[model samples]
Target: MFAFFTRSIAAKLLVVTGVAIGLVLFLSNLVLISQTRDRVHALTMEQADAEAKSIAREVAGDIGELASAARTMAGVIGRGHEGQSFDRQGITNILKANLEQNPFAFGSWMAEEPGAIDGRKDDVKGQADLGANDDGIFTPYWSKDRNGAIQFSTFGAKYDAEWYALAAKSGKGAITAPYLAEGTDVPTTMSSIAYPVFSGGKMIGVSGVDISLLSLSDKLKALKPFETGRVLLVAQGQQWLVAPTDELLMKPYEEAGADALKTALSSGTGNLVPNLADANGEGFDRLLFPFAVPGVNTTWAVIIDIPHAAINAPVEAQTLMMIVGGLIVLGAVMMALFLAVRSIAQRPLHGLVGDVERMTKGDYASDVSNQDRQDEIGLVAKALDGFRHKLAESNMLAAEADAQRKAAEGERRRNEEERNQSASVQQHVVTALGSGLAQLSQGNLTYRIADEFPGE
Candidate 1:
């Protein structure tokens, strides 16, 4: 069976067909899986980035409101409290009221001396004193002390932070980067708004408000639904702000990201590290996207992992089915080809061979007939039949010619014998007459010739 399979043309064709079908199915499945991974990655990243942008905008809007309030307050308290003799209690009361009204703000306060309050007040008295500076005019209040900057013993120095510097230099609102609070150790971010207080067109003080980072983290956690997979906030080449807390964020990238990140960065969206081994050494397919955050120098990437075995199951089954189907089709084709060739070519040649065999055996009586086909074999069969008929006719004519020749030979022999006999009889008759005449002349009367001789 093995030899036949190897030698048979039909069997070889089936094997080749099966292999071709399997290869086609495998490549098609690979392309499909790769494209699917890319599409899913693109959609997921787009959604995450959009959510991030929306949150950033919301934070920006909240800071905008604080800045607007500060500007309005600064316009109201024109010119540093020179000869103003204003109601300090009423002003303080208004600032407190504003702080109560705006719950988003951790604390809202105003500072004086045009540059005295550097956002670090060691004591509550110092904070209060800064609030009521005689040489400074209250503009607007916008500042928060989440880390207890006003605490007497442990108040740390807070000067020239990014937010404070921006507010003082640009005289505008700014959002600070995320950081750990001094006393609480809780991750916090601040948004500050400062408006210049002017006395006679000369700046005297500034007002600002600070917001906490707790609300932002809460919103980040809820960026996507629970079942919608993972949502990550990564700072380019740094750390992931939000990711699955259980797994080490860097580990997945170190292992799977090696190939996936390369592909994502190079190709934008496609199969990166396909068939990557997981922590347990199981292979998985990974998809990645490079998240380009606005106003940030670093690029954030998102990766998704799916098992290779799961995706390839369908492809394997499909390949098997195609191979079997191709084999069946090949079998049918070969069978038909063989039968058609035999009937058209081989069978007619076999008939001609049979005719030759019969002729060799001297059995020329058998009729050589052929089918009504116009192909080469059929034409050959027709020619053979014609030759056979001519041979039979020639044999018959030769037999007739031989019989006539023998009959003519026998007649010629008989005619020659008769002629010779007739001549002899004539010769004898003449001689007898001659002898009788001679006897009469001799006159021997005694010896008379008997009228009826005994011998006559």
Candidate 2:
């Protein structure tokens, strides 16, 4: 193929045309694909931002209910419904109603400081004495069973649980960072919102609700913006809570590199991360959309990672279309070039060949019509025409010389015949004279002189 392309003019021309067309197509496709990819990335980022915000709002609404419910119940305890002491039965009803109202709240508790509700020590009923190491704080916990039944439990005042201690000291409602809560049928992750109870300027204990995070994990798993895209909840310090699966839970999110996640968390906006690699050494260029869940103290962010291939599919399709169109145009140009070269170059050369053949046969009268065309073929025709004229002139001079020689030969022959006749006449006259002389000598000269004369 290389040799044929090197040797043949049409092949060379076609190759050149193809190469030019390919270069043009390549550049055009690059520009088009680049523009298309930009547009897609922008649009996808917008959509992802919207989705992240929507999910953020849902999470806020779900977990925010804990704080709201805890504060509402604490206000109830502070302002007694009966205008007397705090109603234990009423508080229990409120906790049951809160658990039933919000599906995300798995448990509710009201833990009081020692002697805050009743100063008498023995007034407390159903209290299980742990040991002499107790801190004397009383906590009443109400939780719903998996089958929707309300169950009661108690915690010691000196339990020293972080959520209770923080809420008790802060004297206000506060949400805890997500943590795995024990004592469930199945171990589950949860967060609690604790609101300190106060009655008449006196500090009481804390009232709060536990919001289960299992649903958040389920929501994250169900989310799929693209075929390979996923949503992850990155808590403070890059801890993964609600990721794709349980194995990914509580793992460090920075294994995929922390720069993009840090940017998203700090900026609280959508960002496009270039060529991010995963833990297993598989790299995927992704986009990050991070939004903070409202009403939470933890610096948590929701992030969405979209694969770059999802954004480039349309650009690739458009580039393929450009290549196909370029190929069609190249084919058309090649056909036109081949036809033009054949007509302008090959046909005239074939006519010159015919002229040479005729000249070889000694026939030079025919004129070459293309001699005045002003191209290389015309130059050849003109030179052939000059050779034909020269040959014709030489033939004409040869014919004239032959005619002159024949004429000279005929004149010489005529002169020679005349001389011969004259000689014959002279000979006859001499013979007559001789005969006359002989007759005279013999006495008979008058007989031949009168009848035979030289002029006759």
Candidate 3:
């Protein structure tokens, strides 16, 4: 079946057309898919930005509330000084209640003379105790930084300590930055609000609240619709603050981050990057878009990947349909051509047949005026007419020759009858003369006197 189809000209033409159309459609579909991917990425990034802004606004409000509570607590602690012991139980209870109310907060606490202690020494002591010791404790939190980096107040498993020193030196109220829990494998960003508790017009201690990066991750994860599609929280050229999972998104900017910021800053639009291989060496098409998060100098980007094979199904089907249609048209044309040639060849033959039939019936005596036409059939008819004329002339000549032969035979018989009659009369006369001469000699000379004699 395949061989037959391949051999026919119409089939071959259809195959060629099918291939050409398929290629054209394939390229068109690729362009369309890429464009669609870009549009989707742009829309997704816009939504991501709006989502991040909403969350950031909510976090900001929470920080403000925490700061207010910390200020009230610091005032209470300061006023209770000088012969009055601090209400440590009350302060701890308040911090625990606030932390429980906001699940996003990892921990919160107040510290006096934070810079006086060494963070490394505290971290080593905490690890040595295996979390059994609770004295000399410090609350861990992040300081606000546009450059996304892991930062916190403590070096223990519960909090990062890099942000603590910066916050302490800056003497700023609150700090926000990306971080990872010491013991746990999860990476996050925290927003911390710190207030100093004063004693006699001098700074005594700082109180603050901490929010986990998991909150941002949860919000971004909820925005994604596809299993393969992901929303990445990338800070310009630094790192991915929020990503899908450790295997898919947890990495430095040069490692696994979607380079959307570079593309957007350079081109002012989304860019597409195809993955040549996954963990299993599978290839996939991907799209990226960079978006500027509101109220933040740093930018964020989103990436999406799709299978090329799935996107090309419609074009293949359309190509097949076109090929089928072309083949049908070609078949129709060939059939028409065959019929036309047969009709043209048979029309003249019909006229020639009619002329031959007429000639067969001895009808050539009639004038063949129509035979003078200037076509092959007409030429045949004219030749037949000439042959018929010659035959008729030969027949007339043969009839005349036969009539002359019959007339000559009749004349010869008449002459032979006259000669026979004359011969009989002469014989009778000789016999009578002989008898008369003999009578004369015997004195009987009167033989001539008898006119009615049998001898005459």
TM-score of each: 0.44, 0.72, 0.44
Determine which window of 10 residues in candidate 3 has minimal summed lDDT: 126-135
Please provide, for model 1 over 338-360, each residue's C-alpha lDDT reduced to its tens digit, 9 standing for 90 to 100.
67656665567677889988877
Question: Tens digit of lDDT per residue, candidate 3, span 1-456?
Answer: 698576444445555656665666567656766666566645644654454456445544554555555556556655654225644444445455555555445555555453222232345343322211233444333332234333333333222343344344455454444555443224345444455555666555566665555565676666543344445554444455565464433355564323544766345476556553455555555555555433222344554444343334444555566566656655665566545544544455565666567767756566554475687657776887788788678767887989999899899899999888778777766677777788888997565734233443
Query: Which numbered prediction scores highest in TM-score against the true structure?
Result: 2
What's model 2's TM-score? 0.72
CA shift at 390, candidate 1, in angstroms?
Answer: 17
Q: Comparing 2 and 3 by lDDT, which wins?
A: 2
Kindly provide the TM-score of model 1 when superposed on the true structure, using C-alpha atoms.
0.44
Output the lDDT of residue 361, model 3. 78
What is the C-alpha local distance difference test score of each model? 0.52, 0.71, 0.52
On the 0 to 100 scale, the lDDT of residue 307 in model 1 is 50
Alpha-carbon deviation at 398 in model 2, angstroms: 8.4
